[model samples]
Target chain A: MTTTALKARKEFGKTLASDIAHRLRNEIVTCQLKPNESLKFDALRLSFGASFTTLREALTLLAAEGLVVAEEQRGYKVAPVTLEDLHDLTHARILIEVDLMRRSIEKGDDDWEIRVISSLHRLARIEERAPEDYASNTEWKAAHRQFHEALVSASGSPTLLAVRNSLFDRAERYRNLSAMFRPHPRDKAGEHRALMQAAIGRNADQACNLIASHIQTTSNNVAKYASGVISAG
Target chain B: MTTTALKARKEFGKTLASDIAHRLRNEIVTCQLKPNESLKFDALRLSFGASFTTLREALTLLAAEGLVVAEEQRGYKVAPVTLEDLHDLTHARILIEVDLMRRSIEKGDDDWEIRVISSLHRLARIEERAPEDYASNTEWKAAHRQFHEALVSASGSPTLLAVRNSLFDRAERYRNLSAMFRPHPRDKAGEHRALMQAAIGRNADQACNLIASHIQTTSNNVAKYASGVISAG
Candidate 1:
């Protein structure tokens, strides 16, 4: 009943759940598991090699994050991606990311602006290549994500950024789907540069418009491939 | 491989994990578990009286949904809500919901409009008073959610709708937080009426703006109280 005891009890409870959730999350987000893939318990148990208690602890955390789909009679499967999902996701992505960018443009200081510019520079230098057969190519993906993340990092709202990050992750699966098919567009670099320039110049309105269009551009491209896959099946 | 053999392999591979994920998702989203609460596995296992495999399946599914947060060292805990999170979440909510409303309006026919009107009416009739001494009132919450969901149900984009639902669940936690503070503004009824009218009238631009403002109005109110709490602490 004491205050200290109550605090300890609460902390202990939180610690366990969060730990399990973290491991499961990294596995899914990292694509250690494939999309729409079934997650078998015995397999998962052996994979983690942890006790049932600890593994359950982790899974409950993952369930809350929406990486897996829960079926009625069926068990969890990795969440699937479709072109329709991608389009809407991109729409929401542009809305949130562009909004964040605009906010960052308004609230961001010179240092924040510099950070955005630097992240862009890193992205510009990294060459985009196939994720497979071209092992070094993942650096490009990582850099590209960092650049986009940097633009909104100074938006001054953790919740917005967190949601933004989740949307980005969901989009990533779709992005991967399209990765092997199309050649990297030439204009992407130019598009990003314009976006950075607008933000740094504090043209919040134009920046928002550009970001929205930029987000839509990718969605339109991804939709074609996703639709084909969905339609074929 | 024979067709039957392949089919059997697929069937056998799918089990336990996703099944548990589905059940756990329902428990969390239906508010079976309180927000910011810890999910104790031992207790959950006993409650369901199922094996460890069954529980882990459910928890993993929830994690994918972003309803739970995974901590590195800690176990699974329900995602917490703060005033900052509410502010960001509400803004994102308005952005998505308003856009969905516009799409729904554009795609909706007479029946779609009727559904919205009916859902709002049902919500208006629901008793807002707590249902019992211990349990939160489910009827009002269900009605409230249905009204908003109905507005976007005809948006014709499953992906957008799914993301919208996820954000709504997170927002519910904040709503719960605000509920404990004091009486919310009483004019929510009027605002919903206006929103429904604008959508039915097919005033896409007006409906969009109205919804944006409508969502902001509530967010601002809730946030004001939440901020006060933070500052006091």
Candidate 2:
């Protein structure tokens, strides 16, 4: 084979591995694949229809993101969820995300305001359209992520935004896994509306407090609802 | 071959890839491998005595840490050092690292105080013994890292610490590559001593301010010294 062809083939292999990883990442983050579930080579090979090398590469990527746990010679498993982890993640997010939101409120221009409102509108639509399965609804998840991202879109720091993103994704898993049905769904629309109102009004203090409360409320629900699945300790 | 032997061989392959990556990281971070320099696979294979696959894996790991940049179909280059990057990294580090330091000052216990003193002592020793070559001195590098790490060791949040560590390493590159000769050397030992004093005094405000100033001072030195190598824009 020509050198160019060999390089192309190698690139193709990498892209394929990454593609498989993306699919697995989506499944794992949304709880389509349960936490602590064994990801045996045989079973995953059947499911992903990729070679062991490709599958292993994909798993390694997920492991780096803390979604999958690599067991030296044994293989991989979905990382287990526990309330303790949720509390720590929630606490960190509050510190970083609230600071980001405050900066966004202080510095956000008209374009930033527009994005906040647009994302909020989209999120509200998904909540109304897919209220029943909103927890596991992929569309809702994306819209929800967009709304929060837009809130901090003008944080003016890529580094802080990256940190916020990682914490958000880790928190997403716990939210999806727990509380399939909330006796009271915690007035998410009202909370989001208040958040938007405070942000656009340039009330940094209110926005920060509202976000801190919003994050903790969800965390509380996850703790109570996921008691069966996650240990409190 | 037995199944066990095959598994062992696979593990060994991974270990070799990671070992090469660690060696490359130390060299790159210490500026032995200059910034924006090409990382041709052939040269790396000859130098590291590793196969193409192992070297590629090693490069990929460094790429993830922003130590290496991958150019499609052209292989890789060490990530560039720029004044703009230094400014942004410095700003972000000030926000996160200062907050972490404040938390440590507020919450750090007796043991944390001991670590603070010990790390400061080590850092001072390196600055005195290796003053001439401290910038590229690997021992000084490790000592410097430990001192900063110890400052935020009681931040009570792993997430924030991880963010601080990444920003620290990225900034380390700029400082090493750009300021091999600081006209004033910035009195690093004095600054570190002040940070330790404020921290141990349980004075969060002073400690946070001191850290912020300490970071900006180094950035100022890098900016002026590296004017020749980096475009100001």
By TM-score, the best candidate is 2
At residue A155, candidate 1 shows an lDDT of 87
Work out the TM-score per prediction: 0.73, 0.86
State in Å the error of residue B46, model 2.
2.8
**Candidate 2 ranges with C-alpha deviation above 4 Å:** A1-14, A71-74, B1-14, B71-75
Clashes (backbone N, CA, C under 3 Å), per candidate, total 48, 0
- Mind giving the per-residue lDDT tens digits that candidate 1 earns over A1-233? 66785445334245544544555665665566877888777787786555656655565445444567756355668777655566667777876788788888889988888888999887776644342333125677678788888788788866557667877877766666665465554257788899899989889998889888888877777676546553332
Task: For candidate 2, write residues A68-153 as lDDT tens digits.
Answer: 88775677999888777787788888988888998899899999999999999999988888777575667877898999999999
The fnat score for candidate 2 comes to 0.25
Candidate 1's displacement at residue A166, Å, is 2.8
Query: TM-score of chain B only, all predictions?
Result: 0.77, 0.86
